[model samples]
Target: MKLQQRLIRLSVGVLLLGLILHVALLLGYEQLTYRDRALQDLRGRAQILALNSAAALAFNDTRAATENLQTLRTAPAVVLGCLYAEEATLLAHYSPSGARCPKRPQPAQGAGSIRHVESVMVQDQSVGQLLLEERLPTLAERLPRYGLLLLSVIAAEAVLILVLVVALRRRVLIPVHDLAELAARVTERRDYSQRVSTHGSDEIAALGMAVNRMLCAIEEREAAIKENAHLLQALIDHAPAAITMKTMDGRYLLANQQFAEQLGVSTEAVIGLQDIDLFPTPIAQARDQADRAAAQAEGSLRVEEQLGERVWLSERFPLRNAASEIYAVSAIATDITEQRATQASLAQALANLTQLNETLEARVAQRTFELKQAMDQLVQSEKLAALGSLVAGIAHELNTPVGMVVTTSSTMSERARELKAMVEGGSISRSKLTEFLEDLGAGMSLIENNSLRAGRLINDFKQVAVDQTSMRRRQFDLGALIDDTLHALVPLFKHSGQRIESSIGPQIACDSYPGAIEQIVTNLIQNALLHGLAGRKDGLIELGAHVSHGTVQLTLRDDGKGIETQYLPHIFDPFFTTQLGAGGSGLGLYICHNLARGILGGKIEASNHPLGGATFVLTFPAVAPQRASDAS
Candidate 1:
């Protein structure tokens, strides 16, 4: 039963019990009082009759005695009985007609020759004994009146109890029950606006107030969350990058409009489809490999993949659950096929420019031999025009490494000085120096133990800046070249409390100018650390290099402030900087862009890091060295 019903029943039961006990006690008291009163009246009348009878007998007046007896008999309250001593002499008796008294009634208090009796005596002799008995009124005369009175009192009490029950139900149970129903409705419909009525300052009213307050809080939080979700959806819908999410087992969970458009499919078709399901042969393999790598590393992985005639710059990252397990993967791809074509065209242009330089140099030498004075002015003009374009492109390519070298070399010089001072102060003993020498002697290390990194930085820069200033090709491990570039730049990152982490795949051989590859990697790492972590104090820079199909792809990323969507498309432009004035030379990425395109026979692009930062990806084709016969 409900609480209200239980309470009401208990209350009624208690009231009924009290009323029944009270009625029973009252009836018992009334019955006992009536019986005592009747007995006393009978005793008083018997005493008067006995005294009068004794006086008449003592006077020897039979007539007076008989008259007195008749008079007593006529009295409304008296019944007379007569007796004779020893059953010999006659005596008088009186009783109501048809009222039978017991033939022998023994009385112990007094007797007229009986064992116990109330008697009248003459000259010390007992004439007869008087026996009186009291009779109570009948049920027909009194029981109906008493029963009516009892029933009236009970009816009044019952009416009072019912009134109180009705009042309680209205003032307490009704309001409480209404509030419970309102709560149920609110839960069913997920509507928080319905409120309970508060009629008084009782506990129920307080409960209503608490519920209203809770609903208000819930509504406010829900509104804020919904607003955030709307804003995020708007961002995803309009983002320039193609964004999508897929299950860990390779089923697509969601694909934004941009991704759908890039894949030339509808969003409905793209969702729930795996890479192999949605994409054709080669591109699907690249995507699957990237997804596996991302899941394995539990981090982001980027790969350059070709779909039909288009090139996509794709990044895959593991989406983790609360338990730190990879639950899904999110991918963002940018179409860079046009960018790659532009880069190839630019490389061809640079090669033609180089051929023109060599031809002009040879022509100048020949003309000088033929007529030194006549062709001087003409040679100079040709040199200037050819030099101008070379200067612009090469300058763009050199700026990144030059800037990084300057930064890293300076820090290395400082560290060297600090080491020198420590040694001079006896912090490094002669025994420690001997141990270091022994360790170094154990390997044929080309770079010096003390200044190897700084020296390599200088050497790498010189190959691009001076020694191999012309477009020259060589066969080398592209993965190793990237690794060496990151190693050289470690000091600069160390100065900023950051580390360079690399995942270079096994000996990826490529025929390309190492200077260009070095410059591209240097620029990417520098940009990731400098701009990606603009305000960060400590961070990590990840460099990954691998050979797939006929190309070597390198990805550099960092944990820092991610790029804004508006600025992502324009990062590779000549002079675009999100950090307008705070020491941001837009030429950094611009240089990296041109080098990857012009000198390295590759393509470069920038994007927002999925794990929150910036990422630069470079893809270079593997080629064989040009033989002397082929050059001719």
Candidate 2:
């Protein structure tokens, strides 16, 4: 409801609440008053009857006492009348014609009725006692008349409350409402001249006066705001760094002198021009995208792009209004090409190569270090991809047996239900029972066998996956690692429509890093698939290992195209790829070479097999030579 209605309701509700409380108090007093009156009437009647009945009691005339009690018939409230002789002997009893009276009347009858017992007196000598009872009015009998009176009083009070409400609305509410309207108008027009009448010392009038003062303050702020605009323009022109602003669509809104100098344009020519009009095609496109990203960003964004021949680093942020809506994007850019030459900030910020500001010797050192780190990351990525591929293959292998167990379990449950129904219905036969038991046995056997297969595949894959990913060095059975690696390669073979076999047994053991060996083996298999078995389904890979003295030499040969004579020497060099840009990273063999030497303390040689395709033989100790890191 509106304030007008709310105030009026409050006025009327207060009056009604007061009237209800007053009526409740009045009714409570009236109840006690009526009860007291009943008791007084009963007492007075009892005293009169006692004096009249004393004669009959002293004369021993019960008939005379009965005649005297008959006087109570005139009082309709009386329900019982009794007379007792001085010796506590009943002399007479009286009630209404059809009403019954108890022989022993209680002295106290509580709230419903008033019972009075009086002793008869004859010349200061007591003769007998008289008992009288009168009924008190119930709430039902009393409310009708009381409620009628309350309604009349409530009607009067409602009329008075409405008059008061109307007066309050004009004096207090009207001024408050006028102040609100004035505030709204001043806000809409931003005009300080508008004011509400403040002709009283009331709170509402004071509020109107405060609003007028606020308008004056706002007018003063407008002058300050205009002054600040000029200050901002001067700051922008004198700014140390180049500053520019553009809309989300790339139309320039502002540009400082430094910005114009870099663009080789005047300040006037720079405004209203898009990035494409100022920079080269590629540079303009990149900066334009950066502008759009800044406008859409929640806060500041960093952009690096080359302008002309110098690289510039820009910090761009959005200009938002009161509603947090982006109206434009602003950027402050600094030429960082020279900066990168003197400092390592670019390397720190981007975690990338930094050789711009270095001396020739230092530049070469930094570049070489960065290349090494990049190579390591690339090799790690390749290793992870291989591991992931193996995981996918092992997961595929587990799905088959797990799926079989699920299907077989469901079938067994249904068969058991059918067998239960047969027995329950007394229709089970010897043949059917035997067949059911045999089928259950077969299902249990199938479930158990497949469960074990899934478990074994998981356990085997876990060892390989953990070893490859963690890169932790430990002792492992060379034969078992080779078996697991080859088993994991089965999926790769199936996918490529090739075959791989291993002749090594579990007798030969290696204490070297199996993880390194696994990667080398995987890379060789994949290399064979890419080059030797690219399109041939009959491709075969033969893996053989043997121990000599204290060294274990493993050989992997594939029945595919052999390496070309010219590229054979460079095959294991970093970034050496005969199939460049043909889905080959060129770092696989390089990674294998690094792991063999640096990690395993061994060497790997790549050559074309004389009898068939390509061959890779990796030779390392049964127990690996101490690594430089471990030795240090």
Candidate 3:
């Protein structure tokens, strides 16, 4: 709505607000006065009745008291009334509605009703009490009359307001409408020199004068702006780069001479034209996409364009008005065909250099492959060396017991020969016989112990050698297997003065490849001996195995120096070792890791123990996973 209409509505709203407040005040005042008048009238009537009943109450005349209350018939609002003696005994009562009065009611005070208690006195002494009640008129009963009066007044005022509105619209709105029409003409024609005429000395007339002065100032500014725009156009026309301004819908608003030349059109002809009107469909579509992207972006965009066998690098950016809204897209383009050609030549040179570098890399890769092959050969050799060590240990262990048994057999045969010679001469005595039997018993005991020791060695070596060679799956006691592997590994430690603590927990049965477990254990123990011992001869290697919840845990700890921090993470990587040449082929722990995880379905971790040494933990399921075979 126009300001004129708003002002008229505001004036009428103010009048209605004031009228509403006045009506509220009237109603509030009437309610309070009504309550007071009702109470006063009722109190006066009750007091008169009290005065008249004094004689009856003093003589204890119930008949006279009843007649005095009967006088209340004229006041129908008095619903119930009662006369009481000094001791609160009822003397008489009256009710226009035939309702009984309450024997004991709290004294109430409110606008809803009026209850008056007046005392009867005889000769300055209390004789009786007169209670009167009256219901006051409610607001509902009087609202219709007040409403009628309010309507009549409102109608009269509305008529007056309507006349005043007509006068204001003519006096103020007419001039405002004329000024608005003048502004519209100036804006439509883009002419700031237009001005509204003034007639009176009022605010509307003064507004017209101010607008005239503003128009004069704007007209001067507009002249300066036009000069600046012409200068800018001349500058762009002479610029080396092609420059143009396009609206959001792709129509050209300003095209410099350079841009017009590129489009094969005069500058005047290029105005209001679009890319689609000048270029082919493909080129036009590409340009439109780039322009739209730039207009939507928060900043400028750089893109390449192909136009008539020439490549141009364009910087496209949004053109925003004073309100920071993008109204068009402006682009500046420069041909870069020669520059791009030079870049292409340089790129080819880089490609040739890259090929030469790749050739050198291939030679280096070949050398690395030869070295890796040597390392792999050492790995195979180390496996053989390990098995040879096991055989050597077994031989050394059985030698001692075999020698003991052979020596005892030879000594016992010599003793038997001496006994036979004595018995043949018939000179054998009881003492000699007894000595022979005792010597025989001692020799038998020595042979028995040696035989048992040899048997155990052979049996353990047999089981381990078969398992390691066959690499087959089977169920066995893990604790016992560990003990056997350790036994075979005894020679590695025995001569080195390293002590081993073996804690093989009970009931550790496993359904897995014993050979893999054996290989992993052997590697860990050997790795510990070689690296973890750190050249300490008396290092302690603790090997433990236990089972719980169908899983087995095997841990190997060494009292040697812990693994070097820099080499810890790569310890289990193939061909990664600090020893490299000194007893470590760099594959011991790597092989152990592979066997434990790949064949035994277990996880292995290596860490430096807090106390001292490197710790390797291997955990595996007791029942190994059934693996798919190759080519399956």
Clash number for each model:
8, 2, 0
Cα lDDT of model 2 by residue, 1-632, tens digit: 34335454554444454566567665776676777777876876676466446547756787877887787776777888988874566888878855555565457867678788877765466766788888777977866535533433444566655765576778776875776577446545656677678875755565466556645644565567668887997898888779998876788999998898876778889889998888778878888788888877788998877776786778999998535678889999877665445234312422211121123235334433543454344446755564543443344445545555666666656666675565444344558767766665665566565555555444444444322322446788888998876654443354456888889888897777776687678778878888877879888899998998988899999988888899988988666776777856566787677667766767899888888799999988899876533432
Name the candidate that leads on lDDT: 3
Clashes in model 3: which pairs? none
**Candidate 3 lDDT trough over 10 residues, lowest sum:** 462-471
TM per prediction: 0.34, 0.28, 0.27
Give me the overall lDDT of model 2: 0.68
Model 1: per-residue lDDT, tens digit, 193-244? 6777776666556556755665575456557767988888778878887888
Error of 2 at 499 (Å): 0.1
Better of 1 and 2 by TM-score: 1
Candidate 3 global TM-score: 0.27
Question: Which prediction has more favorable lDDT, 1 or 2?
Answer: 2
Clashing residue pairs, candidate 2? Answer: 341-356, 341-357
Segments of candidate 2 deviating more than 4 angstroms: 1-470, 628-632
